[model samples]
Target: MKAYPITTRYIKRGEDFIPIIIDAIRNSGIKLEDGDFIVLSEKMVSTAEGNFVDESKFEPGILAYFCYYWSKYLWGYALGKLLNIKEEKIKNLRKLPKKETLRHKETVIRTVGLRYALKPYAEGGLDLTNVPGTYVSPLPKDPKKWAERLYNEVKKEFGVDVVVMVADTDATYRIFKWYITALPYAINGIISGIGVLGFLLGRLAEIFKVGGFAGCTPLAIAGNKVYKNYSIDQFVRIAFICDRVHNTIKNINEVLEKYNSYVITEEILEKLKHTPVVVVKIKEEYIPNR
Candidate 1:
């Protein structure tokens, strides 16, 4: 399958993103075709919808401390290694300063739940990267509705039918025949709602020789596509491609280390190219029981 990345001006909170998407497609020089797949970044859409949350606005309490303990002790010293997490990350987790991350942990518990609090990052898909200070992007409200709107709008603009998928970098892992995602709200039959248990199981499955982890989480699919047209396995493959192409998107930590958190403004972020939209061509059809 061939994939094309569309670049547009950085989108800010509450900005109208649909027009930007359409404009990017128009300038991309890649014609949208029937049966193509259009993948969107959840971060971009959530930001456009003003779904970002400031952790500083929240208060950390006892339960948030427990989450801190989970990160510092369980994940840092024990579970992280078992999950084959990188040593540098484990070390950072062990050194998590309560002063810095406590409020964010509180926000995670309040927004998602205690179950999601067990996760180090991407708790219930309230991911904390690719944004300016103290902000997290939660799962977009009615993601499928958003996908349908974008699909209809794209079709209206281009006069071509296409599959529209909205996905996040938070992962969906596979073990044997079972598919489970780190975050809830994954669509097209990828199981979720188990909280971090899915991540634990999918990682541990490697030791048990059952299965291993796989692609990023796809939250919504529109145009009666994905599971209806393509096999779930094929769709998962498509999602991974989108995630890889999105590497052009920078992590906020890049600037946080060089400059003060308060000084790393949106203008500096605009210096980076964010590939929030990727269009894919399915070169081959999935054959049943092939």
Candidate 2:
């Protein structure tokens, strides 16, 4: 499989991202072909979809405080080892400042609920990285809509057979043929709403290397893969390819450290590259004459 990353400027909120992305792909000098796949970063779609929240406006309740402590203690201590999460990451979680982060935890509790609020970072896929101060980009309300629009728009521009996927950096684990993820939502194929346990169990297995792959999962899919009835495993492999090619998995913590503050400013963003779109060409041999 061959993958190409289409680079674009930081896609801010209120921008017409779909047209801009298609234009980037057009200018990228790569030709879209039949059976190709287009993978989009969920952050880009969610931001353009206007999902940013002013977290400063939300107050943390008792439940939010509990989640904050839970994240600092449980995930920072025991759960991290069980999942074999990085020791440095666990240390950071342990040292999370209540004064700086409690409000965000409360926001998660109120915005999504206790289920996602229980997890440590990327809580329900809500993140502050690459976003402006006191603002977070929540999960897109309708990922399928984004994927469908991209599918149609790309075809309109390039006139080729292609599948469109809006995807996240989060991984989905396969167990006894059941594909499950910690994500609050997923596309039609992978399972969702499993919450913290999904993350724990999946990462536990991942620690020991359990699945054929564990990288990224599609939030929603459209076009050729839907018509072909591609298995969840097949689709996930495609997402993994796109994710690794771009390899933009810098967590919010890293972003915080780089800027020395919880708030990621526009000056910090200038130092980073945003390639929210990837065009992929898969070899039929990846699935053996499918």
Candidate 3:
């Protein structure tokens, strides 16, 4: 399989994503063909759809405060021991900033639910890694529809029929053929929700053998005949390869620090080549058996 990262200008809210994707493909100089898969970061889609929350506008409730304190001070050790989380991460959890952490937790509870707000980061696929301060991107409301739309739009504009997969950077755990993730919503037959409890159980299951953090979560897939029989492991492996190529910068902080800006300003984004879309070529021989 061959993967090509398509670089383009930064995407903004309410902007038409199909055009941006077309521009990226043109600039990358890679011609699309039948059976090709287009992998897009969920953040890119969310941002384009204006699916984000500004934490400053919301008030932290009592439940949010309690959960934050318990996770940081008490629950961290228990979960750490159970899941074999790194000592460094456990220690960092204990030192979470009070004000900001509360705000984040409150936002999570309000948006997704308490079950999801309990996770450490990327709760219910609500991500803060790529966005600026006080701003978090929520998972697309209708990922399947988004995938279908993108697939149809690509076919209309480029005249090439291809599969579209929207994915998240969050790692999914695998136990044999079963894929488990802590995300609140279900995707591609993977079990979700149960939050930190799911992480613990998945790790415990791994102790038996052949299970652990696999790769990026495949949130939605549309088009293509081969994908119908794809296993969770296959989705993860391909998604990981696609994610590594699409990320131009390491994290949002790096971009902020580079430009000395609070948010992802137009100037900073314009200065860097952003690769949000990736073309993945899948050979028939490379498709893993279900």
In candidate 2, stretches whose alpha carbon ends up further than 4 angstroms from where it belongs are 204-213, 225-227, 247-249, 284-290
List the candidate numbers ranked by lDDT, top first. Answer: 2, 1, 3
Predicted structure 2, TM vs. truth: 0.90
| Model 2 / residue 212 / CA error / Å | 8.8
List TM-score per model, in order: 0.90, 0.90, 0.85
- What overall lDDT, based on C-alpha atoms, would model 3 receive against the true structure? 0.77
Model 1 agreement with the true structure over 29-67: per-residue lDDT tens digits = 988888888999898889878898888899899989888
Q: Is candidate 2 or candidate 3 better by lDDT?
A: 2
Across 1-290, the per-residue lDDT of candidate 2 in tens digits comes to 77788898887786768888888988888888878888888888888877888889987788888988999999899888777787988998999889657888888877887898898877888877768888888788888888888888878888886888888877778865678888888877677887887887777666666652355788887887543667788878778888786745366667666666777876667567888888887753434345
Count clashes in each candidate, considering only residues at least 3 apart in sequence or on different chains. 0, 0, 0
Each prediction's whole-model lDDT (CA): 0.79, 0.80, 0.77
The worst-scoring run of ten residues by lDDT in candidate 3 lies at 247-256
Across 1-290, the per-residue lDDT of candidate 3 in tens digits comes to 87878876778765768877876686777888888999988878888788989988889999889879877866467866566776766776776767777888999889888877777655778877566556888887777887888889888878988989998877788877778888776575788866766666667777766788787788889986768777778788888888888756554445545775445544555577777888998873445459
